[model samples]
Target: MIVGIDLGTTNSAVAIWRDGAASLIPNSLGDVLTPSAVSMTEDGTILVGVAARDRQSTHPALTATAFKRLMGAQKPVMLGRTRFSAEELSALVLRSLKADAEAYLGEPVESAVITVPAYFNDRQRKATRRAGELAGLRVERLLNEPTAAALAHGIHQREDKEPFLVFDLGGGTFDVSIVEIFDGIIEVRASAGDNRLGGEDFNDVMVELVRGQLKGVDALPLSNSELREIMRAAAERTRRGLTEADTAPFSLVWKGREIRRDVRADAFAEAAAGLIARLREPVLRSMRDSGIRTEQLSEVILVGGATRMPIVRRAVTRMFGRFPNASIDPDHAVAMGAAVQAGLKARDSALEEIRLTDVCPFTLGVDTVEFDRLGRMHSGVFCPIIERNTVIPASRVHVFSTVRDNQPVVEFGVYQGEARQVDANVKLGQLSIPVPPRPAGTVRIDCRFSYDVSGLLEVDLTIPETGASKQLVICDDADAPDDAAIAARREVLAALKVHPREDAANAATLARAERCYEAFLGERRDHIGQMIIGFEGVLQKQDPKQIKEARDEIERQLDALEGERFL
Candidate 1:
């Protein structure tokens, strides 16, 4: 059976359409949510999800989290002794989700529909698909996250038709999609987002607060990685705490002393003014692109876990002069809607009459020559073909001729963005098709771009006079790995042993205690240290009952010191 997965930046989840409704698939621990974190032990054993996340502060060097932001950068992230590409790291998360789905369904699952931020460029989308491939799943579709959330929202509404907006602020990405539904048909009018803006960026604002407010913080012995992860965890907790209370303590230990500050909601809002401002552009752009005014929207729907924050909700309220809808669970909407999409792909009888259409989030075009004010030919000009927000599956064609007489070849540098210059846009790929030598205007070539439902692009070029033709698939050279490389990475991942599931709770508890030990001071620090020692001693005893008892007690003690329930 095909499943739908939200391969999120901070957390991931999977769901399937069963009994005519979408249901979340639980993992081994009976939790539907999985933290998107990966860690490598000293013995080369891998740990994912909560176990790895708990290790972030304790074993900062060995753990990697929030790697989704680097998806299309083709950069390597070091996890212990190994260097993993963002694709490889994402594949591990996907693999874990796949296992959970299989376990829940009691059957082997192979195909999936994965959701991505609509603002992701061609390279990022392709990288996501590659990640799915590496995890042994045939990616049926790469659904836009906001669009998916829209589907989930539309499904539960009683109205036959309505227009709405989806505001998605995920862990590492933000997207806004304008949607309209009419008589079982869902159409996305426009999409806009910043792949770099999200909840994690807010965490950065909190980190900056610590650096600026805490004395001698700049002189601390923390490495860039350690400081970031450590402060991010603390800031995240404080930020969440502020959601329910006006003030929350942001504290950490340095040497033998405790440093603390009360973070006020008003202060955080003031410091994050720039980020709140950044959120305005996308909503305005989506509204403008869709030709819909704020008042025209029947409801503004909030999606993604980040939207639960009061600050974000207030921003949306101020923008629209109305309270946004939060009827759907922000965290589960995308994955659930993706499951609905998986059902649509399968032509499920229950959804046979429903139709969904989505827009291309960015403009796709090619480089061309344009005459400047002085009549001088300027190359590297961007000539748009498929405009952003054009509904897909879509195809558009444009004709062009050589700029120079007797030009031997016609080259097209495919790009995606809103820039007027090709260099300012993202280059998807380049294509060269041989043309018959002739005067500048004598040879005419037609370039046709076809964008499919799954968000892949195909370019077809044909010269009318000579019938010469060429085809180019949109993919970045550096971002697209060859089959051999994929196989090699798969082998590398398969060879590593995974930390035993039975011991995950104990490990997580110990890791959390270590993190607390680092964050506490004086007596509390000493107490956590002794607790860690006691847990290790229990593990060495090799008695399950004794270890479980010790682990539970230590977790309770850390919870009290951490005030985790308050957060």
Candidate 2:
């Protein structure tokens, strides 16, 4: 059976298309959204979701979360003596989702339609597809998250002629898209986003607020883990409170004393003002790129949990002069849309009557001849094959002549991006076509660029003069390490001796954090002294084991404190 999956940064969800409707499959705990966290028990068993997240307070060193932000990154993450690529870590999450789906359906599910941010570059998209494959699921298509949300919105309304904008701000990514619906056709005219921006930024703001408060108390010296654990809990609560209340009450026991603070809506908005401002660029740019004015957008649809913020809504309303649509649950829209796409893929319902066309968010181009000075040949010209806003399922061809006479083959460098210089763009891959050895001008190579609904690009190099050709699917050839290699690396990663959960690394992190806190505390030593005394009171009641445990917790809090500054 075909299913839909939303592999999010902080959470993941799965849904199936059945009985002409879409239904989300809850996890074992009956939660529609599962935390994207994993932890290994001392016995070697792997735990996912809430159990893993719960362990973060006591075992922050062993738990790994938010790894999704590293997708397509060249760096490797070291975990439990095993090194894992971002793709591999993502695969584990997908595998967990797949297992849940199989249990719900009472059958083995083999294929799915996965949703990604519309602005995900070729490398990031390819990594996501590979992740699905590693999890034993055949990815029929990779739908854009915003586009998928738009599809769900369109399906619910059954509108035949109207245009709307979809703004998706999830845990770790943001996407803005403009879609036009006409005669059962849903076409995405433009897509834009910052892959690194999301609700996490809001949590960082809260963390900073707490750290700032603690710094005012000058006498206490807390460890990193202790500070991180406290701040993490505080940030999480603040994020949840923003969804329903104008302000959130925050309190945490630090250094022994109970510290209390209230975060008002205005303060929250002020702290995140920079991020809110940053979000407007993409919305305006997307609208302009789609050739659709803000006034032309009939409705602005808000999806993803981050959009629940009043600040975000106000920012978008100011830009479009209209209240955004929230008819569909923000958290469920993407998965529902994925289910809709699954229905189309499985041909299980009449939803197949609807068609969608999406475009590559970035420009696709190649290197060409620029100019020569004093008997020299310079190759720096960037020739674009397709511009950003062009409709998808489209192809463009460019011809280039051999620079040297009797050249056996011509090399075509394929790239993606809008940079005029080749160095500034991504080198997707290269294509070389064999041709009859003839004069430079006698050989003709036609380079064709085609992007499909999945946003995957295909490049074909043909020597129409000699009827010789070579085809390269860019996604299939990127220098990603194979699954076997990744697995082998993971084995090595697992063997590496990671610092103990309560090791000296925690102390060092805490030392650095304490310095920052002390610097910030300045003259607030009296308040800090009271809190430190309270912390010691709690510490005195604990046995040696408990003191060590408290120390570990304190270290985690410190990490959270540091994380706030960096974020």
Candidate 3:
């Protein structure tokens, strides 16, 4: 059976189609949502989800989170003594989710439909697929998060035909999609987004606010990693609190003293004005591309957990002149919709009547040369073969001639974007084809681009005279690992000891206590330090009852000191 996975930046979840409906699969901890965090212990044990997230403040150097923001970048994340690419870190999370699904379903599941931001570029999408492959699952499809939400909301099942907009603001990415549904068809008219904008950026704003308040303090290890983590955690808590209350305290304890600042909702809104402004362009662009005015929209649906913020809700109201739809749970909608898509892929009887048609989020084209009226030739011009928002599984062809007299080879640089100049667009790949030595504009070549339902691109070039042809499939070949390399990395991951699932509560409590120990000083610090020692002694005793009691007591104390986790 194929499961649906939401491999998100802040959290991840899995779901499956069962009992004629899509339902979320609970992990070993009996939670449907899992924090997308990974950590390595000093003894070479790996940890994922909440246990790893708890270690962020205590074992900052060994923990990695929010790596999804760098999905396509060639960056390395260091955890303890090991260095991992973003894909590898994501694979660890995917592997954990796979295990959870298998355990929950009592079957061997190997295929999945993973959700991604609609605005993700080709490289980022490919990286997501690669991450799934690394996790020992065959990635059946990469579904757009917003589109998935539409499916999960059962928009296609409605008898009325109407247009709506999906505003998706997740942990590290933002996307806007214009959709229309009629006659059992859910059509995505347009999609646009910013990969860098999300809830995490708002957290950074809160972090800055707290730092400004503590500027007068001296000799505080503000630059320390653990302290940074502590501040981030505090900011997340305060942000969540501000969702319901008009004012929330952003406080941190250091050197036996508590430094605090009460942040009003207005102040946060003012400080985050820049981020709020960034959400406008994509929304406008999506509407423009879809040729739909605000009045034409039947409803503006909100997706993603970040959309729960009152600040974002207010912004959406002002943009659309209506309260957006929120009946569907923002966090679970995408995963559930993905499961629906998985059912569609499996041709499940319950979903036999539903159909979905997606759009190309960006333009796909090749570099070209243009001659001005004065006969001056200009190169690096982008000639689009497939424009943005075109329905998927589409194929388009364009013809071109040789640019220079007797040019030995015709070079085609494939790019994707809205720029008029090729240099301004993202180059997906390039190829050179040898041609007959002919005068300029004499040799003609046919360029055909095929984009499939799964978002893969194929470029075909043919020369009529020579009957020569070539095809290029867009892929990140330079960074893609071979089978042997993938196997080696898989072996490395499999060889590491994974923390026992049953001991997760104790591990998480201890990790939080360690962080509290690092954040406090003087007597309170001493108290936490002693508690850590006592807890370690209990753990060493290997007595379940004793350990549970000690862990519960520690968690209660930490709750008094730092409050419960924000989630």
lDDT of 1 by residue, 1-567 (tens): 899999999989999988889899987656788889999988888888887887887688899989999997868999877899898889999998898888778899999999999998888888899899889898898999999998887777734656789999999999999999988888999999999998889988987876777666434434666766777887998888888999998876655566778899999988899999999999889988999998888989999888988899999999999999998999999999999999988888988867889998899999999998998988899999999999999999999988888999999998999999989998888899999989887899999999977666889999998888999876333456688987887888877787666776776676677777788778888988898998999999999999989987887887788665221
| lDDT by residue (tens digit), candidate 3, 3-66 | 9999999999999987688899998777899899999999988899888998887789999999
Clashes counted in candidate 1 amount to 0
TM-score of each: 0.94, 0.81, 0.94
What stretches of model 1 exceed 4 Å from their correct place?
216-224, 475-479, 537-550, 565-567
How good is model 3 by TM-score? 0.94
Candidate 1 least-lDDT 10 residues = 214-223
As a whole number from 0 to 100, the lDDT of residue 396 in candidate 1 is 100
Model 3: residues >4 Å from true position, as ranges?
155-161, 218-222, 475-479, 518-534, 543-562
Q: Which stretches of candidate 2 lie over 4 Å from their true place?
A: 218-226, 372-381, 402-409, 434-444, 463-468, 476-567
Report the poorest 10 consecutive residues by lDDT, candidate 3.
213-222
Candidates' C-alpha lDDT: 0.86, 0.76, 0.88
Local accuracy of candidate 2 as per-residue lDDT tens digits, 272-308:
8899988988887797798888778888999998888
